[model samples]
Target chain A: MIKATNLTKQYDNGFVAVDSLNLQVNKGDIYGFLGPNGAGKTTTIRMLNGLIEPSDGSVTIEEKEVKSENALVSKLIGVLPESHGYYNWMTGREYLKLFAELYGVDKKRIKSRVEEVLEWVGMAGKADILIGQYSRGMRQRIGIAKTIVHEPSIIFLDEPTLGLDPQGQKDIQSIITRLNQEQNVTVFITSHLLKEISEICNRVAIVKQGKLLEEGYLDELIKGYRLVLRNENPTLEDIFFSLTTDEVGGSI
Target chain B: MSSLIKKEIREHVFSRKGVWIFFAISILFSGLTYSFISVKELSLLAQVEVNMTFMKALIGISILVSIILGSTMVSGEREQGTLESLLLTPLSKVKIILSKVVGILVFWLIISVISIPYFYALTYGTNMLLTILSYLYLIGLPLVISFSLLSLAFSTWISSSKNATLLSIVLFLVTAIPMFLSTTMKKSGFAHLVDLLSPVSASMLTLKDWLVNRLGFFFIFMDSLPVLCFLAISIICLFYASKKMDFLGGE
Candidate 1:
């Protein structure tokens, strides 16, 4: 579970990235955070994930504040940033092992944990190969493997399906579902793809220009948005259109 | 912290560039030692007199390698987009910075270990080997740590590793220039400061004392204050960079 209260970020140049935005992600739910380019989505995520400090307000995960001593908060969370970078000189297994150590996984169990995560991400076969030799999809899977190597309870995945083929996207989506259903891990995902959110996320929050426009369970969001529209069966895209503006970051 | 240090050490050890640099220096050291010892007109004791020169060479090479690693560590991580992943981890900045310091020193330690036999042969039948060992700890350790921290400051402050490297080279010259100019400048506060706080200058002074004047252990410790001064300044710089500079690194 996570909570953000009046969370805001402002730059020295008088630009506001996230402006007093409030958000909540429930336990074990696939929560989708939808926004367009520079919509302050990534900035909000960065604040929540403890990469940057917010100018105001606060975020807490599992009752722990993400800003103060979030390194401790990081112990319970795994993150796959939008532009995940792998150590190209390292083997997939080696990379997993390195993160395993960073996450304070026991040295004795590192080998098993590395293997298990690699297997979970379907990278076990290529675990011995250098990441530089891996395909983009393979690298993405290995990135996910490293993210969850310590079995964190909450996983934040940014644009998990970006640049992937249909099959690769399906495979990643399946893994997301498995993590939610089988492992009972909270999935916080961000994406521009409305269809992907509709297919996977149980709850959704739509934001534009760092401001939250709408948030609720997918069914409730659809029902609420449908009341304003004639479409009986509202798609996520339809709900998004009804709730948020087309204007992006600069105008706001 | 140990894991991070080990990871960094493994990277350097496995790198082809590191291997070539280490051995190339070693081969050059061997050639220099053999040539000096093989001079028919020079006595074995006279050959051992070059101990200070060989020790200087080792210190210089070690600092060079350590600075390269330290100056690139943060910027390289940022460039590869791995810095966020690292900053997101549970490790503190102190732990990260200290581990990098230890990592670079460990690499230098390995390189220094490989030079021991060559140095021992060069100093056979003299008190020079003992001098080398003493200076290696007193002079070598602090000197390398100072350079490593200074380079780390550059790495944290500069987003581009190339620029960090350039700045480190410039810094190297900045520290060395005062000593060079002091020969012409009178004993001003500036010249006195360089005399007190420049390791390169102290090194030249110490070696001169050993060869021409009688340099005792007391004088050696006193002359090495520059090493301690640089080490203290480097500590301040490291602390500042860790707390104030952006971990994401930038231009």
Candidate 2:
């Protein structure tokens, strides 16, 4: 479980990347955070995960402060940043093992845990190959594997399926769903893919220009939107466009 | 901590950069050794002089390599997008920085080992071998580490590896200027102060006392105080700079 209260990030150049916003992600829920480009989605995730400090307000994971140096927070959550970079020189197995050790996995269990994660991400067959040689889809899988190598209770994925093909997206979606449903792990994923979010996330939040526009259960939100639009069956795309668009049919 | 250090060594020492530097240093030492053995005018000099010359080259090359390693340690990870993951780990920032320092130290150790045969060959049939080894570890080790830490501080403050490396090298050259100055110029007000303050000059002066003048260890240690001070200052600066280190780098 994670809670952010009056969270805000103001840059030195007078740009407020995330306004004073509140969010709660319940345990074992696949929570999707939605926003267009420059909508503070990534910034919010970074704040919650303790990668960057929020200018004002605080984030607590399971009632522990999400400070940068908090070991408990580090153990509580895993994160796959939007622009996650790999060590091209390292093999997939080596990369995972390195993270496992860093995350304080039992020394004896490191090798087995790495192999298990590689298998979980469907990278077991290619474990020995250098990450640099992997295809983009393969790299994405390995990145996700790294995120969960320590088996953290909560995982934050920032645009995990951004550049993937349809099959690649499906593979990642299945992994996310399996982690939530089977393993009972909480997921806080940020993406602009409405269909992908709708397919996997039970709860969703939409934001624009650093402010949250809506947050609720997906079905309830959709039903509410359908009634407001006077349509019996409206796609999430329609609802998203209606909510995120200005009166002049321009993105706000 | 050990895992991070091992990763650094693998990424750097076993990489092409490490291999090429080792190969080039081997060739340079071979050439220098051959010149001392075969060259007409060079053969006339004392064996200790040739050995000291080798030691000087070794120290210079080691410092350069350490600078390169230190300057790239943080920025390279940041540029490659790997710093974020490392920072997200439970490892303290100080431990992360210290792990990088350990990596540079390992390289220095390897290069020092590589120079052994050359030092042995040059100091053959002389009583200077043990003394040379002692100074190499005592004087040279601290100097190399000082520069490495100083350069690492720069790397933390500058996001671009190129700029950090350039600034570190320039700073090193400025410190080494006293070593290149003429006796007359060194005695001048500004140069004299620099020569007294410069760690490189202090190191060279201590080496000269040990090898050429046969000065007592106490006297040599007194002359090497500046090098020790520089090492202390570099350590302080590095820890201070590391506090500002972040996923994006810079304060």
Candidate 3:
């Protein structure tokens, strides 16, 4: 279980990226974190992963406070950043093996685990090739493999489908669904791709300008929007615009 | 952390640049030493001086390599957008920093070790074991610390890899300028001040003296202390930087 209470992150330049946000993510739920370009989605994710400190708030994963250096939290969480940078010199197998060690898997199991994850991600054939030689799609596949190598209970994917071909996007989407359903992993994914979220995520939180606009079960949000559209013949996209605009105008 | 450290070593030590740099340093030292040996007009003291000069060259080369490796450590990760990915993992910032330092240090040790056989072949029958060991234990440790710390410090301040590289080079030159001037001017006041203030100059001085004759404990102690301090400072600075890292706001 993930719980965030009044989480706030303020920069030295006085920009508040995440404002007094509160949230909870239970086990086995695929949660989507949605926001505009500069919304605090990434910041909130960073804080949850313990990458950066929150200015005036707190986060607890499985009832444990997210400290500055909590290795245990890292052990239980797998993260796929929107853009992944790896050591170009290493082969895919070698790169995955590195994370496996950090995750403290048994030494004998490292090789098999690496192979399994690589094969699962469909990059087994290219496992021996240097990462520098990989295509963008191939890199993304390997990035996902690295994240799952530890078999974390929770997974955080930051725009995991960005810049991929349609086929690559399909492959990742399927993998994410399997991980959440079969493995029962709690997934907290952030993306600009609302369509993808609408299709896969069970719940979503729409954030704008460091504030939460609305959050709940996806079906509920869509239903609420549909009720408004009954009198006006508006598409889901139109409903989204209206809801966001209403929040903006009222808050301003 | 151990896993990250292992990965760092595998990526860094086995890479093309790592191998090439090692081979290049070996060739450089061997060629300079062999050329000196071929000259028959030099006295025994002059031969020792020549060997000492080559050792100094090795020290400088190692420092350069450390800076090159250290500056690219984090900035390169940022450039590739991997910093975010790594940060997402359960790994803490301190683990990442320590793993990086350890990996780079291991590479430096390997390069230093490879130079040993070449030095032995060149010096051939002189009682150079003591000098070599001293250089390895005393001069080498401090040299690695100084360069690693300097590079880490620079990396923390700059986000751009290109800018980090440029800054590292500039800082290297600035640090070395005093020693260069001191050597060229001999016992002048400016040289004295430079020799006192610059770690590189002090290191060169200690290394040069050690190569020619047995160095006193006081000189070795004084020389080694500053480098150790630099290493500690680097750790502290990295911790502080990790604390200050804000992914939400970009400059």
Candidate 4:
């Protein structure tokens, strides 16, 4: 389980990227972090992964301080950032192997695991090609493979399908679904794609301008706001549009 | 740490630019040695001048290559967005920096080893130990120092690899200007000061003199101390950089 308590980040210029944010994610849960661009989704994820120090507050992963640079924490969590720029010189196989070794997997297991992940991401045939030659979609696939090579209990995927084609997006969606349901991994995903999030996320937290506007199980949130007019029935999309528009107009 | 180091090495060795840089250094060093040997019956002044020029060129190349390699150390990741991915992994910043340093050092060692044969063939019979020592002192040590420090410092200060690359180039040129001016105006106080501040000039002066005549141990130690200090400073800068890496996206 991941729990963030009063988490805040204040930059030197006095801009609060994250403000007194409180969040909790339980095991086997797919929690979608939804926000527009520059809405602190990335900042919050960075703090969760122990990449950036929070100005105030603390995050605990499995009851251990997230700030502590422990090997166990690294082993337990897999993170795929929105943009993963890798060494262009290395082949996909080599990249996966490198991380496998870092995660302390046995040498004997490294090759098979790498192959398994490459195939899982549907990039097995391109495993030997240098990353520089791969397309953006291919890179994203490799990024996912690298993140899951160690089989971490918790996976954080930031914009995992950012540059993928529709087919590529579907492939990643299935992989994410399997990872969550079958592997029982707690998945924390951040994206601007509301439709995708609505489909896969068990619960979601909508953040705007460094604050959490709403968070709850998807079905519950939708049900709470569901309305039946005597002569008109509004679709979920219409409700979504109205809520966001109302929020923008200074009413939540 | 070991795993990261291995990854660094693999990246460096396979990199297109890294391989080309090594090739160029080898060819340049070999050409300089050939020219030095081909000139027969040279006056003492001429020999010293030629040796000095060769040493300066080696130091300059070392600095250039080091900066090129080190400049992209972290900024490249930021630019490519790979840094976030790496940081998200469970590795510490210290491990990342150390691994990169080790990788660059390995490259330095490989280039240094390759140049040894050329030096051996150039100064085949005349004071072989001295020739090898001079190369190490004058060329190898300064290259390591300048590259390590400037690269680490630039990586820390610059937000993008392109900026770091441009700044490093400018800094290297500026640092080398004093030595270039000193060579033209030989015996001026300005020359001496420049020589003192410039690692290339200092190394050439100390190593060349030591090669020709026996120096006391105390003098040798004193002369070599500055280079050691530069190296120590480089390591410290690397540590500082690791601690200061923001990880979060910065404006």
Q: Which candidate number maximizes DockQ?
A: 2
Mind giving the per-residue lDDT tens digits that candidate 3 earns over A20-71?
9999999998999987778888889888877778998888887778774367
DockQ of all candidate complexes = 0.77, 0.79, 0.61, 0.64
Which of the two candidates, 1 or 4, achieves a greater DockQ against the reference?
A: 1
Model 2 lDDT, full chain set: 0.92
True contacts kept of each: 0.79, 0.72, 0.81, 0.79
In candidate 3, stretches whose alpha carbon ends up further than 4 angstroms from where it belongs are A231-236, A245-252, B39-45, B182-191, B207-216, B219-251
lDDT score, candidate 2, position B241: 89
Off by over 4 Å in 4: A227-239, A246-252, B39-52, B134-139, B170-178, B181-197, B247-251
List candidate 1 segments past 4 Å from native.
Answer: A242-252, B37-49, B178-182, B185-196, B210-212, B245-247
**Candidates sorted by TM-score, descending order?**
2, 1, 4, 3
For each candidate, C-alpha RMSD in Å? 2.6, 1.5, 3.5, 3.2
- Counting clashing residue pairs in each candidate, in order, gives 0, 0, 2, 2
The DockQ-derived docking category for candidate 1 is medium
Candidate 2's C-alpha runs over 4 A off are none
Between prediction 1 and prediction 3, the one with superior lDDT is: 1
- Lowest-sum lDDT 10-residue window in model 3 chain B: B242-251
Clashing pairs in 4: A85-B81, A85-B82
Isolated chain A TM-score, each model: 0.96, 0.97, 0.92, 0.91
How would the docking of model 2 be graded?
medium
**Residue pairs of candidate 1 with colliding backbone atoms:** none
For residues A50-134, what per-residue lDDT tens digits would candidate 4 score against the true structure? Answer: 8778999999998888887455687889999776678788899988998898787778999899998898888999999999999
